[model samples]
Target: MAEETKVATGYDTKVEGEIKTDAWTTDGEIVEIIAQDPVTAESEYTEMEYRRLRWKIDLWLLPLMWFCYGTQQADKTSVSVQAVFGISQDTHLVGQQFSWLTTIFYLSYLVSEAPANYLMQKFNMGRFLGICMLFWGVVVLCIGFAKNWATLMALRALQGMFECTISPAFLMITGSWYTSREHTLRSIIWGTSNAGMSVITGLINYAVGQHAERHPGGLAPWKGISFFLGGLTIFLAVLAFCILGTPRDVRWLSDREKRMAVARTMANQTGSDRYKRSEWKWNQVITAFKDPQTYFFFFTTVANSIPNGGVTTFGNLVYESFGFTSLETLLKGTVPQNAVSIIWFLFVGIVTLKKPNLRFTFMVVSLLPAFTGMLALALLPKSGLLWARWGLYLMTVTGNLPGLMIWTMLPSNVAGRTKKSVTATVLFIAYCTGNACGAQVFQAKDAPRYIPGLIACAILFGVEAAMMVLWRAYYLIQNKRRAKKIAELGMSEEESRRQGLLNAEDDMTDFENIHFVYKV
Candidate 1:
């Protein structure tokens, strides 16, 4: 093992060793644990012990987050399934009304994101998220009984308000528990749950549709879909409330394990202030907006999500337009498209893990298949390409990759609790905006082929791909400037690492923390 590099100052002492024991001063749990026995804190936990703690965390935490996120995605996307099974006709939806169903959901999502994140910061994140899930599940259940488009709109709005907390909460939690590389890997695991639930929902929709076809008189397939998903969501909400929380709150981890958990995360340089539910900083909020990467995240998210919104909302419709029945569309089109997405996500996760710093490069690479697919859908002969057009549609699922990569960037690149919170809120606003606008692109007037929407999505995909390169360049430049500044200060590598660990405990922003390195 490398020799322990113990750095002592007037304030506190930290050891940069095989098992990091740097405590975030503001995190009472970690500070208390370290203060109880400084000698043991510095010497405790071997590499094997660290790996075992990580495994325990993974065993308990990953599944809850994975399913909660998946449940949210499935609940939201149920509207798309409903659209095909007569929710539109029964609810008297006409022209753009069907599109407005999706638009309003996101509009509500856009408005509620900031407040939801605020509540998360002020309360127990796990409990706040669970309650949000519970209420959204109720809202989803209420949607089953809606008799008109207006009623569905109201329920969808409530659902949006309740469901907006999951992403930001998960991002903050992942950042608190894991180091930079582990954050990327775990983010991908849960992020891919969106597609994973897509597959599950496709199968469920197929079964529900099939059941409806046979009965011909019982519960409407769409309503049945909502009822089942809503119930599943409530069940997951209970799990989230009981099991999902930060290292400080979870009862599953013993005291030693909790200290080790926080210790392991010091390498990230991002503060643990989120776990404390600390006070907000307006300056950090302003810094989040001022950061160039903030706008890059915004523009890139909007560009990528525009196509995502259109494709997801109109996916089954697009498949049906390609000469298949609703059941066939669910089975062959939705399942396979999402299956391709799962494959892409796993492939991206493995590559990023094995070959670090390739995220932006893969971001560009991932968009190519989607861009090419959109171009084909726009320019190719609309009539009778049959399976060829379907293949192109499947390629569009890769568009989800850029969005996933963007989330990974947040935990690894952004620092400071309030800054991370504000940035996540802004990022989701872009997400909601793009999705709302995206739903409108696939107008009834552009049905069957939706050539204009296809063309617009193609253009947006190109814009997103170019933005990925620019964003990567910005991160690289920022990292270089910070590295040069640290070198000029005559800080040795060990000193630089020590300073970063110390800065993280003070809840410093990435800009204020000179030793904070931006991960590309």
Candidate 2:
């Protein structure tokens, strides 16, 4: 009892119950928020209260995240849709010049990731990312005016640099707000916006393409796509800057609501760093580099993203090869394929949300469909299997789902602010590297069939599947090792819970916090 009390009272308390850290007087902001009324901080709220709070968070945060991500995705992949509508010809792109556009975008994205992640850790994530989106919107709008491939490449590079902050920032934001159980579903909801926006963007692009074809005097169809997407992105940026920030910074929530929000996520064991404010820990960053799971995440992202990069850039072309006209490809190929992706992600997300432990299992299972789809594309007779090929193309989109699952693991399993930032940096560097490499694989010489690219994609998905199995095993082993240590300590359930709550506020890395349990 004495030890538990000591643990609970690690920080000094004022008359008003404000927590004061020893090393830094004003740190542990979440703890301080809840500590204003220590008794309520220790007490459990009703299920109704938690549900109501979650509903409020969902209402305020998710839709904005969804819209923002959707706009980002549409802007990023606009070139793919534009290629079919005559951007390639208008810009005088030669062999592999088109592929280089995607490559340069990711190369810039790769170079910018480390610094972008550093800024995310040091600032208000929502505001920082909103500014980034705003700049990228301007770049995308400028892409509409480029008259040559060189100008397009320069604009793509700038877009990549500006947009590199989105994924890591979103990951951190999601982790700060949600519990491990809620992470999968919420991550999927926002993450699936890529596919969701595709459906929406695909319809708009098709309509614009039709109008451009009819009116000789109007702006080019490809340019129209960029103009519309860029404007939409700028509009969303205004909302994001105002409405979407960390719970600690948002204006809509009262102090009581903020405390409840922090208190509710205590079981996550991943400490909140939102209000900690610019405290960069070099040791945690070092530990992130040393951790074995970091490598797994890096390798898995590379493997999974190879297929993603190839297909994303060349999806419309692949569809065109399937006996469809330019406009028909948008309706038949891009729209339907992304529509399938939306359903697949939702089904996987719901199942994993209910059965949290099955995350890697679903990841591995998701790859199989895409693996089979790519194999069909690589080996089957291209002339006769039009509808069958279309269905298989749809299956390939499921491969992207596992990438979302990998991201969920970062916030739930990793602890410490700098460690999470470092891990995200490594993961995204791999993401950019893999996507850049994948872009080059679909060479112009192999156009229409692109057998080599299909074969490579199929092979990479298999590698991703194997990596998933290994990653799951590694997590299970780590969890069992931690559980054994906790068992040896002979702590009661109540004591363990207390210890976990204490650790949750400590900002300790997962390796340093013995009470930290891996969410396998």
The best candidate in terms of lDDT: 2
For residues 1-520, write the lDDT of model 2, one tens digit per residue. Answer: 1111434221222122334332212223533465332233635678788889999999999999998998898898889999998899999999999999999999999999999988887777788888998999999989999999989999999999998998888888788789889899999999989989898988988999889889978999999998999999999988888887677767777666777777777778787533454778898888888889899989999998888899889989998988999999988888888888899889988988889898888888889988999998788885878898888888888899998899999999988878888899999999999999999989999989899999999999999999889888887888787667666767666665666656557676776666677776
What TM-score would each prediction reach against the true structure?
0.93, 0.93
Q: Candidate 1 residues 92-165, lDDT tens each?
A: 88899988888999999999999988888888788888888999999898899999988998998899888888
Please identify model 2 stretches exceeding 4 Å from their true place: 1-32, 36-44
Name every residue pair that clashes in candidate 1.
none
Compared with the true structure, all predictions reach lDDT values of 0.83, 0.83
Residue 476, model 1, lDDT: 82
Task: Name the runs in model 1 displaced over 4 angstroms.
Answer: 1-31, 36-43, 273-277
